[model samples]
Target: MALVNQTGSVFWSSNKSTTVVNTVAQLLDNGNFVLRPENDENPEKYIWQSFDHPTDTLLPEMKLVWDLKSGINRFLRSWKTNDDPATGDYAYKLDNRGFPELVIFNNETIHWRAGPWNGKRFSGVPQMKGVGIMRFELQENSDEISYSFEMLNTSLYSRLVINSSGIMQRFVWVEGAKFWNQYWYFPGDKCDNFGECGPFGICNANPAQMCNCTIGFRPKNQQAWDLRDPSDGCVRSSKLDCGSDRFLPFKNMKLPESSKAFVDQTMNLSVCGEICKKNCSCVAYANMKITQGGSGCVMWGGDLIDMRQYDDSEDGGQDLHVRVAASDLGMFSIAYE
Candidate 1:
């Protein structure tokens, strides 16, 4: 038997006994369902609750936690279909690899990445404008790594769900209109496609452009690039002089993949660039921020991957610094100027 509590109480039983006593109370204010003890005034002391067993949607008070020691990962997985509640193929989970970023995956393949967690929000999710209608928090300690959000207004209804197609969406319920309004969607554009541009390539979705080589670099396969095939990526125009190379600031750019890159959050951009220059294997370097008080650096050892242009008019965008040979730097500067 099952019960729903708040505005109306519902009961369902498979047995013949009419005295099957399973009560569910629905709280209209919080949208909570509590399995209560008989004639209990306080709903807080319920025996069982829906908040503890969330399926795909994370309610206001629920914690999406991950416990590495216990092997309990509590991220959301898409449903099988719109009509089915069964689990689907896509899942959103925290990647504890380099700097602890959030990754959405289709089975074993990464579909999208919400870049490393800065002090405030995910570096990749520039959509989080500010703490207005909602606020998010990431709690990481010895026991758990969890993320949760709460609406500033209790009466305002909002939900985050992962659809069966591996898409994450935010929805708001309009009580006056009696409809659900879509607020946001993950994998917002082509740039969100994991490694859409192959190694050593950068995708600039603004103006709807495809992959382009970094300064001082050219397509490894010039013919392929001319044919609109960016999978070939790019190659350095000349070998890095190491001592003579300069770090060119690619202002307002989405940072490249960090899993394969060497990152030191403690070092400033200048210091980081020096370290990269000292290593022959290091191909590029960049500051962790495009804004003021920017600290920390990410160094690319191999080829760069999954870079995109910044669209500050539409999305919150960050900048990156790319290293290049002195001659290439001069050429790029002259051409742009």
Candidate 2:
């Protein structure tokens, strides 16, 4: 069967091998296009669904997923142009590496990241924490990894889209205004750009100098850093002394990139510190869940990338303990014991 437009052009065609006499197709209120037997209304028994194959827009309840067992990745890709429905250069998908996180890609390269889920919201998007209209969820297991959000009020309309210019933004219907209003946007500032300050550098959005080395570290290229170029990142001012190294407490921090991370949900903050202390490669650590006094452990073994410092007044972000040599700690170090 095929769906044709007014111009007699076939926009969609079904290739089902067996045809049922009483099959029916319906457009659900949640934007799902489902094909099922007319007598059956069970969504689980539907033969096929448009939600399983997404294009540019991600409406409420639509999942952005990665099937670990089958290697099938369902994500949103932007249209080439406002007038063109062809595939564009930007894609928003769930990136399952050391830990699962939402990321926007410019073609195949990472452009922006929403950080990892911390039991509440993405570590980088603190705005998701207290959202009253939307409830976000992230599920990870042996079979698959998925990220999705649902509106609390069924009467409301909202959507998340990766636009042609590579910007990921969320919009909500303004019933009174008779138009869609942008609710949120990623790459909100220079600091939101992936690895904006390279590795071991913390980006602070408020200052004239937006990038700086974390406590106990120094710019790898002092001359370049002085010239407002921090692409070279930073290095330890003193070599790590392994067992004798101290942790510098960086409060209100966006956890670093976790492409090479170690996670232990059963561990606590103190034990997590000991675990990192024992492993010479472990450079930083943070609690995986920030609610109810915090819990779990996530440690980074290599250069800490894509980190940012939030203002003390900011509602989102967690504390991160960065390993530094005892001699380099100076006044920046906080007592970990």
Candidate 3:
């Protein structure tokens, strides 16, 4: 069912509702249109809400969620075109399989990823750390996992949307200019494409050769790599010696894809490293939070993917400790040393 405005545009849409007598509809201050029992003033008991079934735009205070109990996922889908409101080919959603990460999909295929939440922001989106006007939140519990943001100033308006062109963009309303200014957009560069450098490869936006193997690894197919293709990624130069392998630190790194990772929020960084060392399949580990010198633990198993290195001057990228053979440690110095 959809609510049509005076101008004939869809004001809101949701699943068809059963007819109920004496129900009341109200638009709340936070922009939620809710249906409730006439005598009930509580939001928690609302029978339905527009915010729960958003279209393309993610308004302030609107949540993109995954409800574990119901197995329902709420996400943004781009419109087919600027003039048509039909469902489009792109979607912006949260992947909660392991550690949760924001990902954009073109139909069934991944287009880009805004890596896992690292306490302050998504690990891959460094610019989010610098946005002072918006207060972001990531909530995870036994019942649900969700992400949302609200403007600090009530007078300001901003919306995050997946456009028809398949780009995720944020726009802020400019009062004086009487227009919505594009604040940010993602798939920001060639490197931002999902797994642009494939597994065990690191991408640098500023480099002429955008993709390179991590320090202790070599291109899996040098011939393909020399021809400007790196889809095959890299392989370890020396096989890990199980018990004696070292975790080589890489600073200012966009942590690898996390859907197959292991996470323990109770553990510290040092304990996290020890846990990774014990697992033969563990490829990398990093802190979950970069605040107050860092806290929590996240360890990745199997090959690492979609990793990128940011400039040293950037504020938010985290350190990733990659497992390498002891013999290979002598070849590459610890990053940032």
* lDDT of all predictions: 0.72, 0.87, 0.87
Please list all clashing residue pairs in model 2, or write none if there are none: none
lDDT of 1 by residue, 1-337 (tens): 4445675666543222334275545453555555665676475756656665567787776777778789787787888898998888888877765456778889889999877655566766777765478887777777878887889998797888888888888898899999989888889987788887788787777654477887788888888888877777888898887777776666545666777767676799778867877887787676554446777787777777777766667454465656678888775554321
Number of colliding residue pairs in model 1:
8
TM-score of each: 0.79, 0.95, 0.91
Residue-by-residue lDDT tens digits, candidate 2, 74-161: 9999999977989999999988988678889998899998888888899899778768998999998889999889999999999988
lDDT of 3 by residue, 237-292 (tens): 99788787888888888888888888888899988888789988887899988878
Q: Which candidate number maximizes TM-score?
A: 2
Q: What lDDT score goes with residue 261 in model 2?
A: 84
The C-alpha RMSD of each candidate to the native structure, in angstroms, is 5.7, 1.7, 3.2
